[model samples]
Target: MKTQRGDIPRRLDTPDPAIRFYLFHGADEASSRSHATRLLKAFGAAKDAMEGGAIKSDPAKLADEANALSMFGGAKAIWIEPAADEIVAGVEALLEAPGAEHPTIAIAGALRKTSKLLKATEASPHALAHISYAPEGREYENIIEQLCREHGLAPAPGVVSRIAGMTANNRELARQEVEKYALYLGSGESDPVPLEDDVVDRLGAGTGDVAFFGLGDRAMVGDIAAVQEGVDAMSANGSEAITILRAMQRRIVMLAPMQARVAAGEPASAVISSMGRALFWKDKPVVTEMLMRWSAPRLARLGERITDLERRMMFTQLPAKSAIGEELLAVARIAQSARRR
Candidate 1:
């Protein structure tokens, strides 16, 4: 029997017991589990009727279990962990068979373009969805904003970018950090407060210098003494010059878009909200004012300089101290320029 294929079905039809299967692949265990739970719940009352089980790397058992009938009243759901080629043949067999008996859900840790499992799942009547662990560009920012809104907090200005950079493309890690921050702030506040560097430092211990974001914020606020203190602390913590440069680079990139949006008369609240869900702290107003002071031309110049410094840091073997010092000086100069403006 030829099974239906294309986009995965989001919901199952009732009266007649229809088996619905979903496939999710990703490195982030949290994301995979979250997606699986959502699909399971979407099946309505049938969710309770569904028998749940997991399939290992073996394919024969996977096929047999998927083809088996449900014990109770409703459909059966089978989640295959780390779907690999060895299991693809069995999965394909199950897909090819008439799926009148049960529903199957496969959860994979990773997926390749040429995998038979992916192709079969994609082509099968079962629903197929993917969850990536990698934080792609603005998606991380979007997630942070959503989380903030859910927690009834506002993310301080530049917080999203700072958090995003610190996590270094790890969404699950970023999510954990955000959750910790929210917890620290407590859930009772009616208005959002600015998250302090100490909070972030406590959450992201031993990864790198926490003062990077604090310094960036101080620079944004045109606080020379605070910025200098942050730099000094960062240096003392054994942070490399290139790392500092990279942090500065990330800040400039985050600020450029924000400054542009703000200059066009966009509401600060709307601008920050659009960036992501993280609650903006009290310092948002200060950050907003800093954005207004920088102007587009100056921001552009800073970006260009940061990019050049980043290239040198990546390609050359210059002393870490000298390289970092130059970047710091550049940041200080830009802050001065913004203050003057």
Candidate 2:
């Protein structure tokens, strides 16, 4: 069965022992592994259960390990870490003749949503697939609350917003920061403590700045030089290509609908003014400029291309930075072309 990220907690609360195979795949590696660990624990398996196996995309060996008797001869939990597309065949074999003594959870890296491996796992009667993405909006809030409940911390009102501001688009980092905050509060204490705004600021210091800092706004406005500079700065600061690309993708999603409205005969100034009220104060200027620069059709095309770029970054071994750079430059070229016309 396909599972939503938010549903994972509820599902774990009442896990199905009969579901012996779990496919945890997504760009969010931290969230994926975290979920896998929870699934293993649900099956009464230790965190170190994968240490005993010869795993990693070897389907035949995976099948053998699944069917093979454990040293203790009880329910076994075998993990396949960083499972690639090659493991699909092995997973297929296991499903055909599932003698799985324990849950065989496969933790995969960023996979295309239409991946054959992912599809196979989802289609299997005995397997559950959970796709993890970066948490946002209400989902992000829910994660904060959930983490607080798990670690016995009470969140003061608006603490979630403060935590969200500090974390900024990274689910794993947010989770870790929450845990750290909880630890700081509970140190040498016998009971949970209420997490206040001051405590949050103190514990979450130095986490407010995101690596991809203004790149998204630059990309939206077709400021290619600024975007390139931002990318370089972010790379120097230890940001990943996927992280930068995701930031750009978010801008595209936000701009596409507004551009579409403009194309359908709304005035750009009116649209910008309306959207500005809804947009975060800091982002309104660039978004307004981009709305003026891009037409409806062009923004739609950009949206499609951005989606494709995201897929390539996730599934292919192609140079993500190069691909993203080329695409952003192309967007800048479009702006240049518009100016000439």
Candidate 3:
């Protein structure tokens, strides 16, 4: 019968003994794959993966695989990707096989509402079907939080939003990020420490998708040598100076609120924790140092400066590499001199 997305996880984790066939299809293939993965993990049995095309070509093969026993004596679960109406006859054959013991999980793309496979799966008492749709707003946040819990992730505020935004709300990607947190924290299906924003900032950001990470971070923290090194490297690669400024601009925007909190008498750690979780263990000393050094007024001024630079750099025909590097160097030097005094 048709199933709800929220209930599908329960069904996969502890499958109903009466049901042997599982069908998942929808516009969100990522969600479908995630469900299929959950079922496989729950089963922990050997897989007997068969393509939907192969089943469509030989309808009897589906039944043959399902009814057959493994020589090694471990249960064999069938896997079908791109399950479609063309496999209807094969699925029907599997349904008809009285001796079918192995569970079959099928992943399909968006299926037409009138698709015969959809109807057959829904109508069969021995079979189950679920449709996945892209989650919107709070729904996406809720899903991310659930995944985090399963993986022993105790997310701080904004952690879920960052993951959801970074993964573009894809369940599989979100699951991966949460799993990473669990791994890093050594949390194995157990209570985990609050997941912090600094940890995600250092770990997440779309898997190397953000090329601007280092440039801005180095410039803002008054790492004069590092800033110059980063700029020189970018210039060597012919990377636009605007890209560097934009990355720094983002960092400044994120830091502005924390700076305000710090200015209001809260410790940097407290401010950071309020935003999310703390930095990972190994990076604590260095991050704490940076936190102490980041002045509210200076960070605010840098934000303004970087914003204007980014806007002006957009249409400039001049080579901006030297100009941008010099600007960052000035910010770093000022920070350095202020600290020295």
Candidate 4:
């Protein structure tokens, strides 16, 4: 039941009723999440929102919810934001239970190929699983176009690329911008209109500069001083701890598969080169060096630690900035040690 990212849109257009759950996981968690919601958006179906951790302790809770009767007498949809391996048993129960009245969607960050959650989801006949990497080139354009359509905008030619550029190719940004267009166009879920290029100009005129990702870049190269400096600057500039931590986690997700490829004996240069436009050309040199430095195991462990830190920031009353900053500095020290040995 593993689904390709390209086919996600078409499948959403005509979702299978027999499919009880959709698993969207990969490096591009934002995109994965947006896509997961598109299913509900498309059908105008409201979701019973839940966190991914809800079923970790009570494995049967997932199955119970799936079979629960909606008060409004409709098939309810369950949405689990930020899915993880802990929910594998719960998802297994949902899959095995007969006649799940609700469909479920679980969005996750990068998952290992052998992940129990991923494997269970893929193996289930009742679920569809997909991995989202950052989209590149034509795929980027396609994602924007699809978002516009889902949000009820009928963007004209050149409109998609302009929005893509204005949003700096961030799919989530592009999605939000398109929602603005839908509002401007007086468009609705069922009624669409011409989303001219001029509309992009009027609404997207003040789109801010792309976010700084140097904190992650420095951490990968084990530049402790730079990492600390970047964190200080960001904190002074009023950046949130969760935001900073999320950015670092993204770097971990982005490097993971490439590290694996290198661990499998592929040349780092070749793997980086093969990324084509998926990776920013300006960062290619640094990414290549880091890929050489961080092995697959290291990257995987780092990803887990970041995920745990991010979860704590969400669930606990922790000082976000300092905790996240400390994590990044620790990562830098580890990278520096790797350099020495």
Clashes of each: 20, 1, 2, 0
In Å, residue 143's CA in model 3 sits off its true spot by: 2.3
Write the residue-wise lDDT of candidate 4 on 1-341 in tens digits: 99875688887878888898899887667678778777887656778887666798899999898888887886668899878998988999889888787789898877878899999988888899988776655677887888878888887655665565455446787778888888878887788788875676577735233344456667878899887886776644233554445555656667788888887889888998888655655568878878867887888888888779867765466777678678888988888788421
The parts of candidate 1 lying over 4 Å away from their true place are: 1-19, 26-34, 37-58, 63-77, 97-104, 107-110, 129-133, 188-198, 205-252, 255-341
lDDT of 3 by residue, 183-293 (tens): 777775656677887788778854332344456556556788898776766645334464456445545555666667777888877765564332334434434455667
Candidate 3 whole-model C-alpha lDDT, 0 to 1: 0.74
- Minimum summed lDDT over a 10-residue window in model 3 is located at 276-285
Q: Number of the top candidate by TM-score?
A: 2
Model 2 residue 110 CA deviation (Å) reads 4.1
lDDT of 2 by residue, 1-341 (tens): 78876688877666775676788877777778777767666667643344213443355776677767777766667777867676777778777774676568778877777788889888877788988876655676788788788788877766775566445556777778888987787732346678876786566646334545345556666677886775565443233555555555556666778878877878766777785324544456667688787776776787788668767766666676667667767777677566421
What lDDT does each candidate get? 0.58, 0.68, 0.74, 0.76
Q: Quote each prediction's TM-score.
A: 0.48, 0.63, 0.60, 0.57
In terms of TM-score, how similar is model 2 to the real structure? 0.63
Model 3 ranges off by over 4 Å: 188-191, 208-341
- Judge candidate 4 against the unseen true structure and give its global Cα lDDT, from 0 to 1: 0.76
- Candidate 4, superposed: residue stretches over 4 Å from native: 145-162, 185-202, 205-341
User: Model 2: which residue pairs collide?
Assistant: 59-90
By descending lDDT, how would the candidates be arranged? 4, 3, 2, 1
